[model samples]
Target: MTLYEVTGREMYLKQAADLANLCATWVVSFPYLLPPETPLARLGANLTGAVWASTQNKHGAPGFCTQSGDALFKLFRTTGRAEYAELLRDVIHAHAEGIQPNGKITERLTYCDADSRGSRGDGGKTGWNETNGALMALEIPGIYIRTDRSGMFVFDHVEASIVRQDRRKMVLKITNPTRFDATVTILAEDARKAARPLGENAHLHWKEKVMVKAGQSIFHTIQK
Candidate 1:
């Protein structure tokens, strides 16, 4: 088993990419909950593990590991891919349950520790915080776990604002580059259909119901 020594500064994408690449090298490093032929899924799992490693400490809760989760959430927002969200959820749940009776996040579940237990937490030589990292990782998944309903968090990147916001109404000016009518579903999470959970292939599409000029951008509204 390979262990991840993480500091707080590095974000989730860096951690995910590193872990995913590591998973490519070591197949047995973490749990293989992902299916085959899925590079993204594999990377998601490895990223989760990296988050777990950064948070686990001698106390068994977490030291300082938050960026990995952020990275996963960023992926979820940018790609609108539920697989990343789901993987992050699984990782959060595992740690939430894996803590020891004394609230220690030891390696009983996985052999990631290198047996270098000392000033854990912010005081350790590695200077990593796995606990905080693990805890916050679930925020994104928890917010967006519901596809039919409003996700916990929503982001509008086109506005050049990285800030989080509750978009009561959103207009996606979608332009159809091809000719003819293109039939598709615009996956705007409407709380009216709470039962509709977003699966792996959920994407928002813009189509013209009435007269639509070719290569014109359409508008879509969403309330979270």
Candidate 2:
């Protein structure tokens, strides 16, 4: 998508979209029922969006290993495809399921019996998990709405709503229930803005950041 934006080339956009769709297939589309008394099952994890590591590994995991899948969101915006957005949402939400309160996660969120199947091995946090979780929170918008009122999408583990709105502006109320402080990205654009090709690192210019302390609420007002 960035290539397409930079060079005004249709090929790059098509290639990006195709690659994104392929990546979507690696994400689990349905929940798996784990054996009773397992750590994951005891926590009531759904595992609907766990990502498969690779054919060689034969195991599923919380999110992408090294990076957050924010490209999926950019693809959705550029292509206007709802499925891409939904895919990213599922992955991020599922990633949260494996996280412990101290910001640690085991890489073993799988049903394969290769290494004690249902157990989250050794109870250690991988560097990739920590990096990806932070990347997802910082890069993807917690709540996004088209300024023309065409659509709305939420991707974070937070609560948000348009508390008030008028012809000139809209007020959004966002609440974070987690114990950790959250910096949420908010992107609101009209049809014209959405239709334009995004430049490299364009998100920095188009997004608004709101810092909500843990277990607190914040209101952001956007001009239409």
Candidate 3:
């Protein structure tokens, strides 16, 4: 399960996008505007404003998270807004058709609606463990990845092999794509159920303040 499955905050990213737009816009005229979260706002109001505009047409007018959900995640985390979290989950799910084992989130990236009745194909299924899919790589103890963190793996294409050695010891092996090589940090607390209810052991990967190495494989061991 991805981050959306755990909290469903992304479900409301659209709404958050709308709100963030208003918030960011309203603050633009300020003598000294508060800096927004990274990759976007951290870039400045102009960049954040561009993100808002992109959110409006993300995946061409709603139903996408790569742009909006990311924006909302930053907003919600910064402002502690519930609406941002809700829209965050929705926007993420909008693009992500469904979550698969190994953190492969099959995304339409250009869907018409939630049920994915009429959707456009933009090759969202390329299987990239960037942002939304990296949720599966940290399924082991002491493993976690923060998608928005600079210099970290994307979390969409990373696949992890969770091996239980003896009783309390576990080994997590991660495979990444060659496109980007950032050190992704995967953390875990305990095994829990998934948000969307998947057949293959859908477990949530814990996250921490770390990053993933690009195209490189790494392992971490946890002892109970």
Candidate 4:
């Protein structure tokens, strides 16, 4: 997508979309029912969006090893495909499940027979997992809404609602329940805006950032 934006080449966009679909194959589409005694099961963790490492490793993890996977979001915006958005949403939410109160996480969110299966692993504070999670939060919008279709999609751990709406504006109430502070991204678009071609760094223009302290709520109003 960036390549397309930079070079105005149709080939680049097609290649990026194809690559995003290929990456989707590695993501677990269904939640596995783990052994009742497993730590993940006891904690009610869902592995729906966990990405498998490889055929040999046979283990699934919260997000990408070292990248945010924001390319999927860019593809969604460019193609107007809900599947791309939904795939990233699942991964983002799954990443939250393994996070500790202090924002630490282990890469092992597995369902395979590996030694670390259904466990967070003893690898304590896997920096890659933390990096991916933070990158997703920073790059992806917490909530996206399309005014023309009355569509809303959430991709963060925070709670959100459309508290007020009229012809001129829409108001949102977002709450953060985690131990750490959150910077929620809100992206809203009308039909004309949504139909426009996305350029490099287009998200920065459409997204609004709201800072919510832990266990607090804030109201954001967006003009139509």
TM-score leader: 2
Compared with the true structure, model 4 gives a TM-score of 0.83
C-alpha lDDT of residue 67 in model 3: 25
* Position 24, candidate 1: lDDT: 27
C-alpha local distance difference test of each model: 0.36, 0.81, 0.37, 0.82
Off by over 4 Å in 4: 175-181, 191-207, 211-219
lDDT of 1 by residue, 81-127 (tens): 56555545544444433333344444323323434322122222221
RMSD of each: 17.8, 2.5, 17.0, 2.8
Q: Quote the positional error of residue 147 for candidate 2 in Å.
A: 0.6
Over 1-224, each residue of candidate 3 has an lDDT whose tens digit, in order, gives 13333456755545645666664442112112222332212322221111121333332222333322344444444344555544444333233333332434333322212333223232344443244334323222222322222112222446666544445566656766545664544433322311122222323323332345777776756443
**Candidate 4 lDDT, 1-224, residue by residue in tens:** 77876777889989998898898889989878899898889888888899888758768888998877888887887778899998998898888778765658988887898676788664478789989887886677788888766677788878888898888888888889978798777888887886565554555674578899999998989777
Model 3 worst lDDT window (10 residues): 44-53
State in Å the error of residue 132, model 4.
Answer: 1.0
Q: Tens digit of lDDT per residue, candidate 2, span 147-191?
A: 787367889878888888888899888899988798777888988
Indicate whether candidate 1 or candidate 2 has the larger TM-score.
2
Model 4 clashing-pair count: 0
Which candidate number has the best lDDT? 4
- CA shift at 184, candidate 4, in angstroms? 1.6
TM-score sort, best first: 2, 4, 1, 3
- Higher lDDT: candidate 3 or 4? 4
